[model samples]
Target: MINIANTKTSSTEQKNTPMAFLELAFRPFFLCASFFSIISLLLWGAMLNGSFTADVYGGALWWHKHEMLFGFVSAIIVGFLLTAVQNWTGVRSLNGKGLLGLFILWLLGRVLFLMPVNLSPWFIILVDITFLPLAAAALAYPIIQVKLWRNLMFIPILLIMTLINIVMHYSIVSQSPQLMNNASTAMVLLVTLIMTIMGGRVFPMFTANGTQTPRVNAVGWLEKVVIITTLVALIISFNIIDLPTEFKAGIYFIAAVAHAARAFRWKVWVTLKTPLVWSLHFSYWCIAIGLLLFGVAELSATVSQSQAVHLLTVGAMGTMILSMISRVSLGHTGRAIVASKLMTFAFITIILSTIFRVFGSYFLTDYSQVINTAIVFWVIAYGCFVYIYLPILTKAKPGY
Candidate 1:
C-alpha cells in the first residue's frame, strides 16, 4: 500500500536537502566566480612567465583579457543581480533547475571559448553571449511585475554588456585585432561604470551599518555631479582615439577629483578597524587614485596606461569583488559577517598585490619581477577565499 503522507514528507525533505545550496543565486554563482578567478589568474600568470605559450581562441593575450572582462567579471555581475532582484521585488527569481541551467550556460561559455575545438562562429556566438540576456530575463519578470521603473536601468546596462560581448566575439571571428582591443577597453570602462554606481549605493551603507555610525554623509548635488561627470568620462574613454590627449586628460582628471571627493564623505576612516569594511573603502580609493594616474599617464611618458589599468583592475575591481563575495557569502548563508584572521591576511595580500602591480612596476626597473610578485599575492588572496568559503558555499545553510 502507498503511504501518501509519508511520500509528501519525503518529497519535501528532498527539496530542502543539500540542493538548497542552489536554491539561491549566490551559492553556485559565488563559488564558480571565485574558482574561475583562481584558475584564470593561474593561466594568465603562467603565460606571462613563459610557462605555457598557446592561444585559446583568438590570441593568447586577447583570450586572457576577454575572459577576465566577459567571463569572470560577468559571472559575478549575474550572481549579484539575480540575488539582488529577488530581494528588491520580494519575488522569487530562478531556483533549482532554472538556476542550474543558468549556471551551466555560463560554464559552457567558458568551455567553448577555451577548448581547442574549431567550432563555427555562429555556434560560438550563441554559446558565449547568451548568459547575460537570460539572466536579465530571469530578473525582468519580478522587476516588471512590481513596476520597478527605476531599477530598469540595470536592464539596459546588461544589454549593453551583451552587445559588447557580441562585438568582441565578432572581432575575434572576423580576425580584427584592433576592433577586439577597442571592444575590450570599452567593456572595461562599462564594467567600471557599473561598479561606480553600485559602490556608491552600498559602500556607504555598509560603513554605517558595520561601524554603528548614525549618519551617511552624502550631498545630493555632489552625487549628481559625480554621476554626470563619470558618464562624460566614460564616453570620452570609449572614443579616446578620436579625442585629443589634453581633452582626455582633463576629463579623467575631473572624474578623479569627483570620485575622491565623494569617497571622502563615506566615513571610510572609521571603518578601518574591520577588514571587511576597510577593504571596500581602500578599493574605492584605488579607483580614484587610478583615475588620477590614468590622466597623468596620458600626459607623461613615465607612467604607462597599462600600469594605470592594472591598478583599476587589480586594486579596485579585484579587491572589491573579493571583499564583497566574502561578506555576501557569509551573510546570505546565515553566518556572521566577520572575517577570520586568515581572511584578513588574504585582504592585506590583495591590497599589496595592487600596490606592487601599480606603483612597484612604475617605480622599480624590473617589471617582470614586479609582475611575478603581484601574481603571488593575487593567488594567495583568492586561494584563501576558496579555502575558507568552499564549505560555506557547498553545504546547506547552517540552520537547515
Candidate 2:
C-alpha cells in the first residue's frame, strides 16, 4: 500500500524542530490565501465602488479577474496539489528551495499584474502563466516515473488553462473585445470541464471510501451517455460562438444527466452520515444543476447565464475544492478521518457562506450586492479551508 504518512522535515522545519505557523500544508497558503483573498476582494470592492486605485496591467476588471483566477486559485491549487502529489506518489515531493521557487513565481505574478505599464505583455505572460503548468510538470514527473498515466491528463488541462489565461491577457492588450469574450468563455468552460472530470472520479470514490461501503463506481449505460454528452456540450459550448439555443440545451441536459448520475451513483444515504463526504456529493450536484440551468438560459431565454456560472463558482467549485483540501490534507497527514470540531465548524461556515452567495445571486437585485455576498462566501469557504489545512500541510504526515 502507498504510504500516506509524510515524515521528511518540511521546508518550514528549521534546525531539527518544527516551526510554528509554518509547520504543515495549510500554514503558508492559508495565511497567503487568507490575506490575499481579503485583499483581492477589497481591491475588487474598491474597483466596483469607484474607490479602488490599483490599475493592474489591463485594467481593474481584468486585474481582478486575472488575479482571482491565476493568483488566488493558482496558489491554492499548487499548495494542495503539491502536498497531495507527494503523499499520492510516495515521492519526496517539492520542498525547501523547490517549493520556495514555485511560491516566488506566484508572488512575482501578483507583483507584475499590479504594475501595468512597466512590463511588456510577454513579461506579464511569462510571470502569470508559468506557475500552474510548472506545478503540473513537477507533479507529473514523479507520477509518470511511477506510471501514473491517469493523473497525467491533468497536465495538459493545466497547460490549456495557462494558454487561455495568456489569451485573456493579450486580448486585453490588443483591445480585441471579441477575443477577450472568447477567452473569458473558454476559461469558464475549462473550469466546468475540470469540475466534470475531477468530480466524476473523486466524488464517488471519496464518498464510498469515506462511508465504508462498496466502491460506488456507477458503471452503466446512462453513466456512459452522461460522460459523452458532457464532453460534446463543453466543446460545442466553448467552440461555437453563437451556438443555437436548442442544441446547447440538449447537450446541457445530457451533461446534467451524467453529473447527477455520478452524484447519485454513490448512495448519498451513506453520505449524510459524514458532512465532509456529503459536502462533495452535494457540490457535484450543484455543478450539474448549474450546467443544466446554464443550458436552459441559452435555450429557454428565461434563466441568466451569470446565475448558472455562479452556482458553479460560488456553490459547486467553492464547496468541492474546500472539502477535498480539508479531507486530503488531513487524511494524508496521518490524521484520523474524524475532523476536529473547529474543522467541522469551518466546513459549516463555508456551507453557510455558499448559501449566502447562491441566494444573493438570485435575490440581490444589485450586481454589487451579489458580488459582495459572493466574496464573503468565497473568503469564508477558502478561509475555513485554510484554517484547517495549514497545520496539516506544514507538518510532515504524522507517522515517521
Each prediction's TM-score versus the true structure = 0.93, 0.85
Report the lDDT tens digits of candidate 1 across residue range 1-400: 0000100113444365448667677778888877887788778778888997665776677888888888888888888777777777766667778889999999888877776466875776798889999988887888899988778788889899998888888887788877787787777767778778888777877887789886686788888877776777667765545888898898788888989998898878899889999999998888788888879998998888777788788898899989988988887677788999999999999998998988896578987788778878998999999899889888766655
CA lDDT scores, all candidates in order: 0.80, 0.68
Best by lDDT: 1
Q: Over the stretch 1-400, how does candidate 2's per-residue lDDT look in tens digits?
A: 2223334544334433334333333445545755586678777877787876776787776777667666766666666666656666766566556666777787787777777576677877877788888888887887887886766776787788788888887888788767766676666666777666666656666766678888865577766776677667657755546777787888888788778777776688888778788777777878788878878888765677767766776567667666766665666555676656665666676666666655665577896786776676566656665666655666555554
Local error of candidate 2 at residue 195 (angstroms)? 3.1
Clash number for every model?
Answer: 0, 12
Native-to-model Cα distance after best TM-score fit, residue 104 in candidate 2, in Å: 0.8
Q: Pick the candidate with the highest TM-score.
A: 1
* Cα lDDT over the full model 1: 0.80
Backbone clashes in model 1, listed as residue pairs: none
lDDT of 2: 0.68
